[model samples]
Target: MRHFWCILLAIAILPGFCQALDIKGVHYLSLQEVAGKLGMKTRWIQQDKTMQLESAWTKISFEVNKRDMTLNGTRIFMGYPIVASRGRFYLSESDYDHNIKPILTPQLSGAPPGLRHIVLDPGHGGKDPGAENKSIGLKEKALTLDLANRVKSKLQARGFRVTVTRGNDTFVSLENRAQNANRLNADLFISLHFNASSTTSVSGVETYAFTPNLQPSTSRSSLHSSDRKTYPGNARDEWNTLAAYYVQRSLFTSLKARDRGLKRARFTVLRDIRMPGILVEGGFVTNNTEGRNIGSASYRDKLATAIVDGILVYKKTLDRLAK
Candidate 1:
């Protein structure tokens, strides 16, 4: 383990790493400098307080003081909001390491993981019905199970080994869910779920990976002492970011739904997982329209297709990197 960290430290100080500025003790990198290092040309939209970096294969847009950014048109939330000082915008080094570097320059982040076996976890079952919309008769547990089965079928058809945390409406502890995957020696883990909100109008799809050490999750604006803690799942932080990004992008594009953006969270299942994993909030079960949509078999099939597509894309990315 000490040797592993030593190698990571060596990589962090490489030329590709940003020149960091100490801002309230957090390290940050100038947006312009980041763009230059990535071989992207920067353009500022002063009126909108947005800066865009474009290159032959990538386009990223960052807004001053915002945690959400667009990478090649996919919405993703940074660990910290962009900081502005002396007419310049800066991104947290944590964001660069966990989000940007993994997506744009994955090879430098680390070696790509094998993509052969996958474990699909349906979020809740049995007594844990999870989120529900009684008005529309939609239950998150049932929807997740259906979606997981659909995804499993599609994945198996594409020649990948797949396992499910549960085959029916049976309760499985969160820790057991992850441990099952580890025991199976799965290459990837995906937990499927539906969302709900007190506000009925709130609706969208979002994906979550384990939060990087010392970085706040998407829902939090400030870091907490607990943010410094690392877990077994953090071992695959780079791959988690990459997988979540692709899955979120594919879902938004195929479903034509609101892009909630790829997010970070320390969910129990994610924190205990031994391999790259993400928990997907497919949509809101409480939203009137979306709730009805989740009840439909065709929409569920589409969601499965989009998810399978994303996994294929991620696999292709790793394959390309290996060569």
Candidate 2:
């Protein structure tokens, strides 16, 4: 009977075998069923139009009609909004399989992959200056390269091998960046960049993983035909989420910056990468206050330190799971 129950539990999580409802042409699973499978308890807050799934180690909160969700206090954007039907909330099957399940049950996905070799991509070089604040004499390309070097120093000091995509201020194509990492057999890839906005008031840190197959990116409100296509990075969806979560959490907490949430995008640098990869928007260079801060060497050092701290935390998680 014990073995029978274990078999049943295993069967419950299989996408093909699990029960689902067709909602607006998409398959969805009830929050109740999700909670049961994950050994969590569900609490519905009618007043707030929110539902929470809580366990000893994790707390996941979802709001009706919103793609934003929180996991263990860190913000993450779901591919689809939660829907209410018959007083019960449902999560899209795509998000359940690609986002929620991978994050909550990382161990079940597979053994943690090798994390010693890291590839750091400093966004925009040579001719491409990326985002810039002319008034503050700040350039995104120069800052990213400096930050990459600082992070490389810290990571190397910790005994991990690190590689930078471009060692100088020379242009490197997006395709070449991913291909270089693949050729070097890098375990992890991080693309570093500073952001700009027409509204200079916008300033925060954002981390992005490759958008999962069949799921809309965080930037998109609806799924597109291209969302159905799977990329090489999709193979590491679980690891990508885990890595991006840790890095984004660290950046937000350490820098006390606005929490922009963990997002997903089908960026060329991440789409074809063969390893767990993420792109980091360190901060906005357009903001008056933030632009000046970014121009200073100390703040860039702090950014590098925070990023390395996140990498360390991620490595520790893998180490613990391996044990």
Model 2 residue runs over 4 Å out of place are 1-20, 46-48
- lDDT (tens digit, per residue) of candidate 2 on 137-183: 88999999999999999999999999999999999999999999999
Top-scoring candidate (TM-score)? 1
For model 1, give the 10-residue run with minimal summed lDDT: 1-10
| Backbone atom clashes (below 3 Å) for every candidate | 0, 0
Candidate 1 residue-wise lDDT, 1-323, digit = tens: 43355346656774333344576678888787888789898888664499988998998999988999999889999888988754567888888888999999998967899999999999999999999999878888899999999999999999999999999999999999999999998999999999999999999999998999999988898888889898999999999999999999999999999999999998999998889999999999999999888899999999999999999999999999988
Cα error, residue 148 of model 2, in Å, equals 0.1
Candidate with the greatest lDDT versus the true structure: 1
Q: lDDT of each structure? A: 0.90, 0.89
Clashing residue pairs in candidate 1, if any? none
Please list all clashing residue pairs in model 2, or write none if there are none.
none
